[model samples]
Target: MKIFRRLLSYLEPYRIFLIVSLGAATISTLVALGPPYLVKLLIDQVLIQKNLPLLNYIILGLIALYLLHSGLTTLRIIYVNKVQQGLIFDLRNEVHHHLQRLSLSYFEKRQSGRITSRVINDVETLQAIVSSGAVIFTIALVTLLGSLIILMRLNLKLTLLAMIPMPAITFLVVMFSKKAHRRYRQMRRRLADINAILQENILGIQVTKSFRREKLREEKFIHKGEGYYQANMSVIRIWSVFFPLIMFASALGTVIVLYYGGREVIAGNLSIGGLVAFVSYLGLFYAPINQLNEVNNIFQHGRAAGERIFEVVDTIPEKEKKKAIIPPSFLKGKVEFDKVSFTYEKGKKQKEVLHQVSFTANPGDLIAFVGASGSGKSTIVSLLPRFYEINSGSIRIDGYNVKDFKLGYLRENIGMVLQEPFLFDGTVIQNILFGRPGASKEEVVKAAKIANAHNFIRQLPEDYETEVGERGVKLSVGEKQRITIARVMLKNPPILILDEATSSVDSEAEILIQEALEYLMKGKTSFVIAHRLSTIRNATRILVVLEGKIVEEGTHQELLEKESVYSHFYQMQFKENGKIIAI
Candidate 1:
């Protein structure tokens, strides 16, 4: 009931259409019940009593009733369709806005395929239920009740006999409802698995082809597809059993009526016309029972879809970025991690990833953080952008705690270049324009030149208009990295985060990108997360982060003199790469 109400709430703005649909539904059901009763009246009153003129009047009345039913049913269908479409539009937008507001952690925890399935498949399923199944259910109820009231008035004993199969029919329907619910749940789950397979394979198609693992991928896809097929077949098998059984139950009621009512007429206790009317009403009674059974199928499947969609739409967005909205202009970045500790928790306090750690960076300073893999280097930088919140402490920018400030301002003022840069499937110009939406063409060209991307972009057939393809696959790693740099350069924020920005690309490309990086870091508070030591030579300060804490902090020259963790890490990189990076 709650899910149904939630679904209806999506139609709140279109209440006028819903009301018209309801009125049509009510009139439609009433008119549809007319033919059977008119048959009963024709038999008992007109034919048996020899009222010829009355018979003609009832025949015309029956025709008018049928026409009214058809017209109202058509109107009801049309109006309900408008409401369903409106609900779908509103529900999709609501879910989309909710997703957009959620923090990055929510996305990190859930599968993209699962979320996409809910927004697309689930909404479609619910719309079908609302537009068709729900109205049918309402009609079945009205028809069932109206036929019963009239039938009972005609012959009490025959009506009682006719109802003998109803309890059994009801029992069978209840059992089918339970089975169908479970089967539909499995079917939906299988659908999600199939969606996951498709999403992963397509997104990672390059990797599969590069590794020559096409056969393996094909087998895996087939396996997921088979599971979905099996799930559907399982539901079909149950329906084949239950739907036939329901039809038989309705047929059983007719048999009872014909047997008992036939004897009554033979004995002269009931007339032939009276038996005919009883037969008509009994058929009307069980006809709705059959439709009601079909309505159950829609109920079960729609419920399954609703549950999945609600799981996301009902979730509370991560508190990491749920702060107030801040305008872009008020942001001036001077970042500080004040004893900020984070733990990827597993049940209370049983598992923790980071201990209390602290650091500060003033405006225009370049801060370099060095660490081995899983030593929490990336995690520390991630906090400054409010990707994840501190478990115990706070992060601040320009003396205002990040938690207290609007999440928009904290992130908008912080430009980031990740290790694996992502470019949308669009022209080079569009990707750069993403960083600064309103940037003029001249500003974009200037930023491209500074990032060492303008020369190569100009050489392409379409110049700045060249399509990057999916994740910038059309471009080489070096070209993609330069484009990322150009994007951040165009933004021109007060703070910069370079997460292994020079990790990819050839040695020659590295040198070219290094010059560009130097230009980007000028007069901005920057944090460089790097395993390679060469990139941090000109940093104002270097911090060795380990196991979620700052183990050592000093200048590159000072760290070289100490022979501690910093000196040891520097020497290790120098030996492996055959060069001293920060000398």
Candidate 2:
């Protein structure tokens, strides 16, 4: 009940539409009562008297009543649709906006499909109730109540007898309600599971085909489809029985009314027309009772959907402290890490990925980190951006604690070029302008030239206006890498972090990218993580990380002289390649 009411609250903004719709519906239902009563008068008065003038008048009156009913109904439908569409828009927008504010860890723990279902499918279910089910329920309720009052006025004893079987019908509905709600909730979860599997398969279609796992993927989808099938069958099983029982109960009421009312008419205590009207009223009454049952079904479905929607709305988003400071517009680009440590939270447990790791880079210094995979090198740079908070100690930019700086302001001054470059589905110019939204076309072209991407972009079928397919799949790995470098060049932040940025390109492209990087790194504090030792030969300082700790720190020649971890790494690479080219 609470969830139902909360869902209705979304209608508050569209209350005027609600009011206009329901008012038209109520007036139309009242107008419906006139037809049966007119039928009674036509039978009892006009037909018996054989009055031609009164018959024509009655025909005309009935036409006018029907026209009025149709007009009011049209008004009701138009406004109801307005209210429904408005609610859907508001709810979906709010849910999507909240998703944008969530932390990266939140997405890491859940599938994209499950979250998408809450925003699309679940919200759609709630809208069904408001659009059709709720409106019909309201009309049925009013018709049922109005019919009862008229039935009693015509003959109270008959009305009382007809209502005797109603309590049993009510009991059946009450008993089914709890079970139906539970089943619908289960069905919603099953649907979400099916959606999850479908989305995963679609996203990984290439992998499945390459590994010859199409049959296996089909079997997996079928397994989930069976679960959804079972869930639906469970609801159908109970519904098939419940509906029949309700109809049987309604049939009993009609039987008793006919038995007694027929006897009264035979005795001349009730008129033929009055008894006919009473029977017609019974149909109106019992028909709405059936519709109310359908309303119950819709209500159960909506309540289940509402619970899922609110679950997302209630989740805590990334938080910012009240007193967080905004960093200066122009930063000096000095970075310091003092005894920093971090652990990645896996459910309730934490696995430390970095331990007492410390480093410092002065203004305009280029620092490089070389380590094996999973050695916590990326975690160190990620901490500087506050992507993940440190467990102990502090990291400062310039002289301010990183935590003290406002998240948006701090990140705005830092640029990153990741290993896998991601480009949205758009034109090349649009992707480049993403770095600085307000940058001029000339500036964008300049940045592209600096990153050595201008020549190829100009040669494309549409030049800068060419569409790059999803994740830049339309471009080669080298072309995509250069485009990303252009984006960062446009951003031109004082602090830059390049994580295996040039690793995907060929040797010739690597030289071009390195030249671009050297230009981008000038007069900036740069952090580079690389496995190719030749690229970082002139690094201001090279830190060799091992097992979540910095094991060696020195310049290239100094590290080679140490005859330790860095020296062994150099020796192996040099042997594998036959020689190390001096940069």
Candidate 3:
């Protein structure tokens, strides 16, 4: 019920539309009561009494009643739909905007398809409830009450007999609705699982095909599909039993009315016209009762979907301090980390990834981090950007603690290029402009030239306007990396972090990327996590990380003289490349 009320609160902005729709539905229900009464009048007055003059008047009243009912029904549908669609639109917008503010860790823990289903599929399930279910249920209650009053006035004893099955019908509806709610909730979860598998398979299709695991993938999909089928079948089974039982209970009421009323007619206690009208009103009473049961089913389904959507909306978003300091427009990127530590969760345990790691980079210094895989090289740089909050110690930029600066202001001054570059599905020019949306055309071309991407871009048929497929599939890895570099160049931040940006490219591509890096690193405090030790030979300083701690640090010659961790690493690389080196 709390979930249901929360869903309805979205309709507060459009209450006026709801009120107008309710009024139309109420009038339509009242208008429907006219035909049964008119039929009684026609039989009692015109047919039996042979009254010719009043025939035309009664016939015209019935026609006019029907026309009014038709007009109000149309108005009701239009306004109801307006409220329904308006509420859905507002809810979806809010949910999507909230998702944008969530932290990266939130995404890491959940599947993309599961999140998407809450925003789209779960919200869509509420449509039936908002559009027609609420208004129709109200109309049914009103019409049922009106019919009960009319039936009692026509023949009280027969009306009592007609209601004998009401308690049984109500019991059946309540029992079925409870079972339906549980089944529908299960179905929604199963559907999300299927969507998760589909999304994972689509994104990893290349890896699957490379390993020739197509048959395995298909079998996995089929297994999930089977679960979805079984979940739906559970609901179907409930409905099959529920509907027949409800119909039988309602039908029993009509049998009671006929058996009792026939005796009253024969004994002259009730007029024949009155008996006919009573039966008509009894049918009207049961119609709304049955319709209310159907509306209950819709409400239960909507309640389940509402629970899923609100689960996301109600999650606490990443904390953004409103009064946080704003950095200067142009920053001198001198970064210092003082005894930082971090832990990554491993099931019920916390595994510390960084242990009191410390480093300092003055403005215009090229500091390179070299380490084996899982040695916390990338983790150290990630902390500078505040991607994850430190478990201890402080990271400061230009003497200001990073936690004191606004997240946007902090990130805006930093530029990053990962090993595997990600490009959206768009034109080449658009992807370049993504770093700085307001950059001029000439500025874009200048940045591309600096990254050595201008020459190849021009050789393409569409030049900068050529469409890059999903994740830039149309471009080679080297081209993608260069475009990414061009994007960072456009950003032109005071601080740059390059994580093995040339590791995957060919030698020729590496040379171009290295040239771009040289240009980009000038006058900036740069952190380079290098896989190839040869590239960082000219770095102003080098830090060797081993087991989440800085084991050695110095300039190239100074580190070689020390014959420490850095010297050992340099020797290993030299041996692998068949180059003789003196340690």
CA RMSD of each candidate after superposition: 3.0, 2.7, 2.5
Per-residue lDDT of model 1, residues 63-116, tens digit only: 899889889978898999898888888777878888887877788877788778
- The local distance difference test score of model 3 is 0.86
**What local lDDT does model 1 show for residue 230?**
98
Tens digit of per-residue lDDT, candidate 2, span 466-490: 9896844389777888888899899
Candidate 2: list runs displaced more than 4 Å: 49-52, 471-473, 574-583
The per-model lDDT (C-alpha) reads 0.82, 0.88, 0.86
Provide the TM-score for each candidate, comma-separated. Answer: 0.91, 0.94, 0.94
lDDT (tens digit, per residue) of candidate 3 on 16-94: 9999999999999999998988888888888999888788988999999999999999999999989988888988888
Show model 1 residue runs off by greater than 4 Å: 40-63, 320-329, 346-351, 471-473, 575-583
Can you give the lDDT of residue 278 in candidate 2? 94
Backbone clash tally for model 2? 0
Query: Considering TM-score, where higher is better, how would the candidates rank from best to worst?
Result: 3, 2, 1
TM-score of 3: 0.94
Give the runs in model 3 whose Cα sits over 4 Å from its true position: 471-473, 575-583
In candidate 1 the C-alpha lDDT for residue 482 amounts to 88
